[model samples]
Target: MTAFLLRKLGWAAATMLTVSILVYLALEVNVDDVAAKVLGQFSTGEQREAWLLANGYRDPLVLRYGRWLVAFLSGDWGLSSHFRAPVIEIIPARLGASLLLGACALLVMVPTALLLGVIAGMRPNSVMDRVVSVFAILSTSVPDFASAVLLSAIFVFWLGVLPGTSTMLTGFSLSELVLPVAVLALYSTGYLARITRTAMAEVMASHYVRTARLKGAGTFRIVFRHALRNALIVPATVVMMQVPWLLSGVIVVEVFFAYKGFGSLLYDAALNSDIYLIEACAMVSVVVVVLSQILSDLAYVWLNPRISLSGAERSAGVTDA
Candidate 1:
């Protein structure tokens, strides 16, 4: 397990480094334009040249990338042109807001999805199965934006109980968080439920389940001890894998609900062409995605410990020894 984690972390680092290089090269496309955009069109040629020289655009690509990478490692993520603040300072607040929202969504979504799926899979062809399947399909079929709009119309316009925007200007507010979290949870639940349902159904049909039944095991024991544990392996990994999807979904949901999260911040940076902010956001996103996959792999192994042996261990001929 230690080896696995060390390997995954190394890959995550490499992925971030590669993404950084790509981001830097993309920004290097038109140094003159970046300077002009940052300094406004009315700035003189000397101003652009001065900006380029100051930012190390005049240096070799290798040196510039090395400096940028070192600075990024040292927590200097550059300055945001739009916010007129340090990129490091701006990103953490937005990222924290997003993480809070995501944590809430996951708390609500995961158990609900697993319960619905397990209930449906317990009796695959029964009336309950059909009902849960239909619900899952309908929920997953609708996009996040549409869900947000529909939810807002119902909660904000018809009921008038909850706030439409999830802006955390002062601090956290449960009422404001309702619609955004609901939208994210509802959008993802259907797909995850389907996965769990399939896994549960397969486990319920496996020979071990039959053997448990033949050995006079109670329905509860067969379901919980024998079946549910194996069924969770796939769903657990998938649940961890949803982090990136949730982040992507946040872009639409955050914008629609006026939530100042990492996704919406990225949107703002792109619209304003804040290259520094964009780079920071991109790097952060890559890190999140790679880290999520690592978590997924860890979950998979945790659920099935027999496969925890690394290739190096497997090749050592321990069985003969």
Candidate 2:
């Protein structure tokens, strides 16, 4: 376990380094006169040149990348030109908000998807299964933005029961979160449900389940105690992989709902050419993606003791020899 974690952590660092370099280069190539933009156009040529030199923007690309990487490692993410504040200061609250929203959506999505999937899988080809399959297909087919708009219109405009925008001044309230959460839940629930249903159905058809049935195991015990544990292996990984998507791919929903979260911050930063903020957001996304995969791997290992770690696999081979 220790060796596996160390190896994963090493890979994570390498991944982050590569991502940071690519993001930095992409921004540097696309945005001309970054120093002028950062120092302001009204500043004289000498001022811009001096600012660029002082910031090492005048250095070679490799040197500049190394400088930025070092600073990033030391928790100095640089200043946000958009907000006239440090990137560190601006991002934490936005990140927290995005995480909170994602958590709220997941809280609603997971159980609902699992319950519907279990029912459908256990009664394959029946009315309940067909209905769930249809709902899953329909929900997944709809674009997230369209789903957000439709939900917002129905709840905020037509019914007038919920707020149209999620922007909150005195922190968040359940009422303010209803439409946004509903949109996210609806968008993500379908994919999770489909995966769960497929896994559960496959597990239910396996020989062990047949043996259990032949052994006169109760339906509930066979399904819950035996099938569900193995079925969850795939779905657990699927759910973990959604973390990066929820963090970075919710831009449309955030913009539509006026939610002040990481997605919105990234959108605004890119639009305004806030290079530091954009880089920071990209790093956050990369980190989340890598970490979530690692987490998923760990969860799979924990859920199935029969699964061998790299070290353990080598040990088993030696023992066999």
Candidate 3:
């Protein structure tokens, strides 16, 4: 376990470094271009140059990147030109909001998908299976923005029960979050359910499951012990893969709902070309992606009895032997 974690952390660091380099080069290559962006396109060349010089943007590229990296590591995540505040100061609340929204959506999506999928798989070609199949296709077909608008119209305009926007300006309001969460959950649930259903069906048809049936094992015991863990392996990885999608989807939903979250911050940064904030958002996003993958792998190790660090290492050693 310790060795596996160390290896995952190493790969995560390497991934973050690569993403940071690419994002920095892409967004920060020409100092004058960034200066013009930060200063506004209409600003005079002299004003832009002066602003660049004042902010130490004239430094060599390598030295500047090194400085920026050190400062980022030490928590001095440069000022956001768009917000006129430090990037570090701005990211926490926005990150928290995105996390909360994502957690709620997953809380709704995971169990629902897993349950619907397992039920469908247990009786392939039955009415329940047909229902789950149709539901998956329909849900996965709709885009997040479209669903967001549709739900808003239904809940906000027609019924007049839910808020149209999730701004939550005064404080965090569950009522305001309902539409946004619903949109995210509804959009993601289908794709995951399909994957789960396939895995469950395959597992149910496996030799061991048939053997269990012949042995007259209790249905509950057979499913919980002989099938569920193996069935969940694929969906666990898919769920982690969904993390990036969910985060990216937040950009559209957050903007539509006027929610002040990480996704909105990323959108605003890109819209205004707020270089520091963009870099911060990019790196932070990669961090989240890599970390989620690590957690998924840990879950993988648990769900898959055949896979383990020490066992795999010993197997490799025996292979060499």
Question: What's model 2's lDDT at 50?
Answer: 79
Q: Per-residue lDDT for 2-48 in model 3, tens only?
A: 88889879989999988888887998889989888777779998898
1-321, model 2: which lDDT tens digit per residue? 898889889989999988887888887753337876676667888887777777777677887788888899899998988799999999889998988889998999999998888888887888988988999999989988888878878887899899888898777678988887888888678888888888889999999999999999999999888999888877777788778778755787898889999899999998887888988999988988888878877877676678877744353334224
Off by over 4 Å in 2: 29-32, 311-321
TM-score for each candidate, following the candidate numbering: 0.94, 0.93, 0.92
Best by lDDT: 3
Candidate 1 lDDT over 161-267, as tens digits, reads 99989887777889999999999999778888888899999999999999999999998899888889889877887787789998899999899999999999999
TM-score for candidate 1, residues paired by index: 0.94
Model 2 quality (TM-score): 0.93
The superposed Cα distance between candidate 1 and the true structure at residue 151, in angstroms, equals 0.7
Once superposed on the true structure, which residue ranges of model 1 sit more than 4 Å away at CA?
309-321
Following a full C-alpha superposition, what root-mean-square deviation does model 2 have from the true structure? 4.3
Q: Which has the higher lDDT value, candidate number 1 or candidate number 3?
A: 3
> Could you give me the TM-score of model 3 versus the true structure?
0.92
Ten-residue segment with the worst summed lDDT in candidate 1?
Answer: 312-321
